[model samples]
Target chain A: MTSTLKIGDVTFSKIPRVLIAKPGLDGHDRGAKYVAKALRDAGMEVIYTGIRQTPEDIAAAAVQEDVDIVGLSLLSGAHNELFPRVVQALKSRGGADIPVFGGGIIPDADFADLKRAGICAIFTPGARIDDIVREIHGILES
Target chain B: MLVRRSLDLNSLASQISGDTVLEGVEPWASRVRALSKALSLLENDPWLATRFLQHPALAKLSTNARVVGLTGLPGAGKSTLTNLIVGRLRKLGKSVAVLAVDPSSTDTGGAVLGDRIRMQDHFCDPQVYIRSMGSRGALGGVSRATRGAIRLIGLLGYDYILVETVGIGQSESEIVSIADTTTLVLMPNSGDDIQLMKAGVLQMADVYVVNKCDLSNPQRMLSELRANSEARGRGNEWTPPVLATSAAEQQGLDEFVDALQKHAEYEHDHPEGRAIKRKRVQTEIATNLLFILEREVQKMVAQVPDAEVNAVQAGQLPAMVVANRLFTEAFAMVQQGKIEKNST
Candidate 1:
């Protein structure tokens, strides 16, 4: 029955809050939902905003929820425009320190620009759930 | 994230002072960030949050803010109605903070806090602050962080605080203990009026809103709610007002606001007015104490070594012995330091 987590010196015993959102017109939530369920199973409180969320809404919700991490999933090929916009929005809302990671039909060529845009990490279709959870914990730990 | 400091005024002040927004400036995004960060402390480390709540900055907070609770069945448009109410309240020049609660999965402890989805209109408005909360296995609709968040919102000088419960239907009675006015939002043709009337969560509301009035048979539903609410009225006591609304069509909102104001006046003028406020304070105190104890227990459980757990599972160590050892350490830690600042 014990679900608390401890990493390094910090005990993530308090459920780490996370937000997984969709920031565009695409309604494909299978990926986002899977990760959300994964994170929840990993004992984190995950907030999922169904679909068609604006960047400002996502960032505002993240800051308001006081989430430790934010995960965005988009498949409309608009990651170039929207991912950085979400990062920018988070920064404007004083959430620059909140790690921004993403998933969906993103290409390998787009990774560097997106990272420069402030997306800390990206997960593609073949990415394992364990890797996502490990990467997120690593992000939170750092 | 760990609550990284002792949260004395100097520490909290320094935490926010690092931002460009100077101190004493209340109307800025940094203020929102500060409010949010405090809530994180409340959620992640309640032991530290207790110290923050006791700080001088919170000691002098204004006690005038009105707390309204919106509760009903899920998908009953609490968020849409709350958005409309926020729009109306802002037009009346009143600032509002909404704490929308969503249930965590008992299996996974994750939640898809979708209530804020409908409230996109007020996302960027400085006068309106909306936060989504996960229930985290706490029953009675709202999350455990709710009471502390209310205090933080009150400290930030919001004119009104809206608490949107998880709306588990029958058991969400805790709203009555937290909000000065509880608005029960219901849908039409649900037969909930007569059925849920005996269900207990239906009786706590100071106001009843049969939202989505555009649906078929809404008038009948409204009349049913009115009829049921009228039967609960006693001599000279404040009878809950049952109203109808179409949030999409923007109907019945002004009357809703007036009804809320009227109920507030009733509470303020009631012979036993202090009873409601006293109940709310009691709930807050109980929740804070629970938060501290539960968090300490979680920390202790996390610190249990794999060897001990394996020994217990293998029947090498008795469960009671292991539990006693854990409790002993947790109690000693509690005695040693009430706030484990920088333990992260």
Candidate 2:
């Protein structure tokens, strides 16, 4: 529970407390909930903020909830507009150090832009649950 | 039981000490981040949480915030009502902090806390701070960290602290001692009058709100609750008011708030107000002591030999006797050393 903990086979330098939120008008949350539950299963505390959240709402929640990572999932293809808004909101609100992660139907062409917009990691569809968990742990470790 | 790396409490304390602020700018956003980190410590690390809670800057905070706890059955609109109450309080220029508790998975000890969904309206408001908590196997509709979380929120200078409990059923009414004002939010037509009387949650409320009035008229339910209130034995001479509110239509919200305000006034005037606070401290101490004792017992049990376990399993030694012996030995160890390790 300190800066580092070893539980079972996994040793984390920092146990990740994440916020899995849906940004934009999309209401379907199969991917968000799946990743949320997957992270929960991997020994993480996930704040699932449910569907149709604005970037500001997501940022406010991430700060107030004190999460180290904000995971946004959107299938509406508005990731280009909404995802960076989340990063900008955080920067304006004194949470610039909190990282943002993306999941759900993002085309490969948009990956670099999303990364440039300050998304540390993106887990597309068919990304294995173990791989997603490993990537998250890797991010926290770095 | 776990020795965590200490946080920079001296630095955090210097920031929260409101002594230097007669007329100066406040670091509101940084305070929010500090509160979030403090709560995370409370939830995940016990040793550090005790130290943080005992720091003078935090420990010096008087109970200035009016803590109002809302509890009801699931889907009874506790979250929506909380949002409405936060909006109303902010309109009155009162800073608000909301602690919404959800249940944890019994299988994996994990939780998906989603109370922010209904509370998005206040997320953008700098005056309102909301945090969702996982119950983490604590009974009584709150997390083990709630005692510490509410204290931290108070220290951060919120005027109103709202604690929304997990959807509670009968007998999960620990909110009685956890809040200064307890409101039970029930939906219309939840059950018959007889069933309502049988419910354990019915007896412990300072106010009752029959929410979602747009779907059904609450006149019948109101009359029933009035009759029930009249029949009950009066303790402090304050009859719990039963009011109706519709979040969808925004009806009777002001009236409900008025009732809450009136109740607060009544409690303030009564000497029993301080009496309730004393009882709350006693209850919180007992709950926390039991939690710590459970941890110590687990430590002792881990050291028990397999032959002792085999004896118990083979019926040669009673498990109750072994438990009693373990408790005495472990508790004596705590009496000498364990408390010093964490409290320091």
Candidate 3:
């Protein structure tokens, strides 16, 4: 009774691949590393680009990885500088439809700003790890 | 077609799982080029990602390097600014890596990968490494796997890493997630500039620069920026400082660098800020993972027979009964695999 159906080519996958990268120079990657581990444990494919990536590089990798979700981890205080660039590059590269989400030391008030700029969710500090994984699933499934 | 293959995937998995050091560091120059090629292949080949998901380096990369995002409106001179920042950081005796996000090649699913070509001065300089990425159909305007590339850069021992976004309005904001800080660049008197302002530019700004300051009406635009900031008030403990610069002339950059240094120092001193940053990371990971798991479960359940579904629908059986049965079967499959591993 339970063996005859299939969901897409893969079974109940919430983005099988993740492209994780840093956008600019602030040289702190502890947060990104932790998140990669969390995502990997959750059974999603995680490609963690350690540090110092351009938005183009990140976007290119995301496209190459055929990732369902694009997760950017910024601690350089330069998210404002890098987010839009990656977004635009992705859009230009025809990846404007892939779900893009991110987290970092963004200020509280800037949360809405990041969203309006096109990020699905901006998880500031204090956001639960479970919440992050959940949001990735939510964004992809939706 | 996607069933377990003959090759020992488990062996490959075990190879990249722990602290086993991967060799071939010295040929990083060519290795990075190959890495880029492999990554592109993974993007086009779904099986590639599935196969490499177990690679230890893919997930176990370090976090010691700086992650920066360089953003500005089109023609706001981000390329010039990137050159300047990289140049300055180099003069300060820091090794730099630039992750440039560019448009993709439609035919091959690859990027032109041309940012390095533009920054030719640093090409011969071993202190700098530049890599370009294509967005490749990601929503919210950036690629999904940007962090992975950044991690690789850090692992290579670069002191400072820079990310330059493809500057499009609104959608460009995904950079906030990957950068420690973001600098928003603008120019005086562009028609669409007002549109961006009204679209909530103030909040996306960690540092605001009125680029092309050498152009006319710089003061008036600066005043407008100030007015906007004043209206918003000093909302956070760290007030985003506004500066004027001409990326073409390379003027006012030292002050910008100083301001960036000051903000970096402030973040270091403020334990609250650090805590907040950590919290953001935790939330992103947890939320995305759960989302994926639930989706997988749903897919698994969809494989259930229609009669079983109808039985639940008709109230002959509880929905939980169906769900539990499915989960149990799935877990059993997993358990069986684990047992097989132990036996092997």
Best by lDDT: 2
Q: Please give, for residues B256-325, the per-residue lDDT of candidate 3 as tens digits.
A: 7776777677667777558656865775577446544665777787799999989988999999988888
Give the count of colliding residue pairs in each prediction: 1, 0, 113
Mind giving the per-residue lDDT tens digits that candidate 2 earns over B96-179? 999999887776666778777888888789889999888877889988788778888888779989999999988888888888
TM-score of chain B of 1: 0.79
Q: Can you give the lDDT of residue A14 in candidate 3?
A: 24
Q: lDDT value for candidate 3?
A: 0.63
DockQ of 3: 0.02
* DockQ of candidate model 2: 0.30
lDDT of each: 0.79, 0.80, 0.63
lDDT of 1 at B66: 96
DockQ scores of all models, one per candidate: 0.25, 0.30, 0.02
TM-score of each: 0.79, 0.85, 0.54
Please state what fraction of the native interface contacts candidate 1 reproduces: 0.44
Which has the better TM-score: candidate 1, or candidate 2?
2
Selected candidate, larger TM-score, 1 vs 3: 1
